[model samples]
Target chain A: MTTTTTTATAPPTRPVVSRPQERPFGLIRHSLALGRRSLIKTLRTPEQLLDVTLQPIIFTLVYVYLLGGAVSGSTQDYVQFLLPAILVQTVLFGGMATGVNLNTDIGKGVFDRFRSLPIGRSAPLIGSVLGDLIRYVVATVSLLTTGFVLGFRVQTGFLSALLACVLTIVFAFCLSWIFVLVGMLVREPGGVQGIAFLVLFPLTFGTSMITPKETLPGWLQTWVEVNPVSHAMEASRALMVGGSAGTHIAWSLGFSVLVLAVFAPLAVRAYRRRT
Target chain B: MTFAFEAEGLVKRFGKTTALDGIDLAGRQGSVLGVLGPNGAGKTTAVRILATLLRPDAGRATVGGLDVVRQAGKVRRLIGLTGQYASVDEDLTGTENLVLIGQLLDLRRTDARARAKELLNDFGLAEAADRPAKTYSGGMRRRLDLAASLVGRPDVIYLDEPTTGLDPVKRDDVWTIIRSLVGDGVTVLLTTQYLEEADALADDISVIDHGKVIANGSPAELKRVVGGQTVLARPADPARLDDAAAVLAAVAGRPADSPTRGVVAVPVSGDAAFTEIVRRLADAGIAVTELSLRLPSLDEVFFTLTGRHTTEEAA
Candidate 1:
């Protein structure tokens, strides 16, 4: 590729596909093709949809009805306060399936089939992430619809609400790399679930999703301020409910980039090592 | 001339266990090389190395003259692998599985679909092409697995114990498919524990045991190395077994073996020995109900080569 000689430029005599370098955007092409497979798998198995669809609706219902009064002083105020953060939490939870499904597939023939092909080693991992991106979108729409039904109104314009949805998905997509790394290293599918829950509970719960930052004690308040999940949720709430979201949005995007930078390489490397 | 695929001094170990210990295997262009061995004897390990699934600790392997390690990507482009367990995506229908492979190979979407349809029809999976592979029978699943590999139309293929668990009829179906692949000038490296499978398909047989090549030759050559053609005679009178044995032994210049009740069989190096035995048996006034001459079975050759029966080790 550095110095293309005449022989290199000449077409191959064999009808077989040329070298990997010769195929432009081979990574993206293969990854999207695999992503379509994951999407079809999702469509075929309706039960896997329950997490993105029902979990958000059920969580919104129970949270607004049961804990809404005690936390926000009224169910009405709580729906507005809780729904946006619920969108953040639900999408993050839905993202967990990427790792779980990947871990399950590693022991199956499907993973080997992907690895044996002459494609990018990271295609399967990226394809799974891309395929699971829909879950976050589903959670966002489902939670937002439930919120609107429960008397939550968007103070911001349509553009801002849409921005919130996109931001929530981006943050979730970034955070899923951590689970993908775990999935690559862990041997058993069930072990992936156990570790995912262990990491996710603290990451998602430590956020400012349930209550305002002011209500927490000194140490917890400071931790929430630094937590990226808290920033993502904060940015989501502001964009949807109307507030100064400039700082939160910057923090969320910055943290998302940082997490993706650190973990995406690590996950793909772990995949190569594990396989 | 270079072989279609070859492995020289391949050595691989897992912790304390040596899975493949300097095994040499090769397949000529447009022919089959059968790596025959019992379970844990490293047939699969050797195959994995040649398929670029595993790297040999010390050895050189090439497919169509491209080094497996240094040019693994290029190797993948030229080869296909079908594991013992059919590796088709069970969730997808047969058509989708093949189409997925086609797309991975960078075929146009319409071309991929057309290829899938053709392979499905060719493999007699047309009716089940729309059904998820998980629902297909075992034989159908194997056919789809094979079809998936052929999507790229590779010149060399590695079938690692491709018929390990299949029934008799299903195994024959696979053998026919392999024959057709070879008919198209594709080279095949087949591994199997079934002696008959190798005998039926391989042009060359490499008998492996405990990660080493203990014996290597054509089927007829390996049988000759172990011994030679055997002449058998069943006495018309069960009481005359000893007389028949003595007559055959004298003519062949070796002691005859009574492998079964009332049947005396002796190893003979040539057809002359068989005719001599017939003349001698008649001279001794021995009437035989059955008489035949044949090469030694691969089962016996395997036993002679390894000094242990496959059934014993397999069990």
Candidate 2:
């Protein structure tokens, strides 16, 4: 019995091995890794990066050259007037890419994979939203560079111009959460795009992103004055043009806080449901 | 020994459709429990609950003594789950996928990289570690998925149809990996529609149909439940098939099936009946070409219990 046992043990012990010990990371670490992966994907796909860059440049040129005379009466005046509007409109439109990417990820079953892992529940949602900041900054810089080339001046000085640009991007970053919520709620990519367009088109185009609300019809003017996008655009315009801190600035800041409060939780809730 | 995983009266309903109806299961540590079922039989639902991915409408489940509902985080720490399809990010490389999972499970950056390298080498993916998962073959992707699940070194793993789409050779490769995992004392709950897969891997088999576990036991025990033994006989000569059939009929009380082509099958109850049939055939001077006594297979058992063959069911 002893001899037989020794022979059996020798063969079995040669093949049998121990399992490795596991060490789990915290939520913050996981969220950073997810964010890094998203950024890497953005770097690898330069062709897809053109949307945010081109839209800001083309729209700034078109409004500055073609519609500048009709709207603001002078090219320089239109450049000053339309630059801030272009900043707000371009950044807001840039936020839509987040929804589209999220929709694509969900359609491809990427989110389902995240569900099975032991990672933080909020990591994917938060990381994806944060990753789009790269695009927002890219669009903002391209629009600013184009406006500068066209002889547009920032009378509020370099520091204030930088702050205004930051505010516009930050506001756009906040607005992306609303689209992230929509993306999480809708599973299909096309459906997400349609929902995003329906929500964004009127909000940006109908508001004061381009012209002052005082120049519109009485009923149309009333709606535009209260619109959150209008408030954001007007506040941003004031900051760039060396205007006073008035109701538009107060309303824009208030609207930013309100949008974040309402949509952040909704987006997180939708993300939980998705998993 | 205490069970590695247990579920008691697990009931889950999606809208008005009852997916699982009071199912209970207890699996021993370091053993493979194969769940055999047709489609819509709640096999996936049971795995989901055990993996802490779904909540039961009513019931309790525990992994390593941690409640799946009340202590989901702890249960998740102890368990790893691989679903029907490969669930890794296709945009990431194989190494990136495994390392990401390791990092999520809390490994240090260096440690995660080391673990990822080891897993890639172990799964024979070292050469393709840097290639994006979208470029991998089906077998490679499946292996990477399995490697991803093992990144946490889970005490118990839930594999729901791990070999659903693999060819015969690749399926056998996965079976080898599962055996190694069990050797390391990891308890596994495997669900699959292929009866042969269950026969190959399961130490204990549970047959589920229509949201209920109709049968559960060791493979040999369940096969015994079907009936006694069957004696199959085939004639050497095609023309003399009926003669052999008549001889078998006279010996066994139960009528033999008609000689199809040149073979006749007769079901026998016991060794005595089999011996009598052999004696009668010898005495008739008819040389039997083939004679064998065998118990029913799991396929037949499924048919006998469910009143339908596995192939006929749209699983």
Tell me the spans in candidate 2 whose CA falls farther than 4 Å from its real position.
A1-25, A74-76, A107-110, A149-151, A245-250, B226-301, B310-315
Chain A alone, TM-score per model: 0.91, 0.86
Model 1 / residue B312 / CA error / Å: 5.0
- Going through the candidates in order, their DockQ values are 0.28, 0.27
In the predicted model 1, the residue pairs found to clash are none
Question: What is the C-alpha local distance difference test score of candidate 1?
Answer: 0.84
lDDT of 2 by residue, A53-110 (tens): 8998898888778877888897788898888767888988989989889878865534
Estimate TM-scores for all models.
Answer: 0.87, 0.83
Tens digits of per-residue lDDT, candidate 1, B1-315, equal 548988899999888899988988888888999988877889877877887877788999998788999988878877888987778888889999988988888787777888889889889999998998889988899999998888887778888888878899999999999998888778899998766788789999999888999998998887677666778899999999999988888877767777679898877778898888888888888899899987655455555676555556642
- Residues B208-310 of candidate 2 have per-residue lDDT tens digits of 8767789899876665564445667776766777777887677666566642466776655567877887887788777878877765444455666776666
- TM-score (chain B) for candidate 2 is 0.80
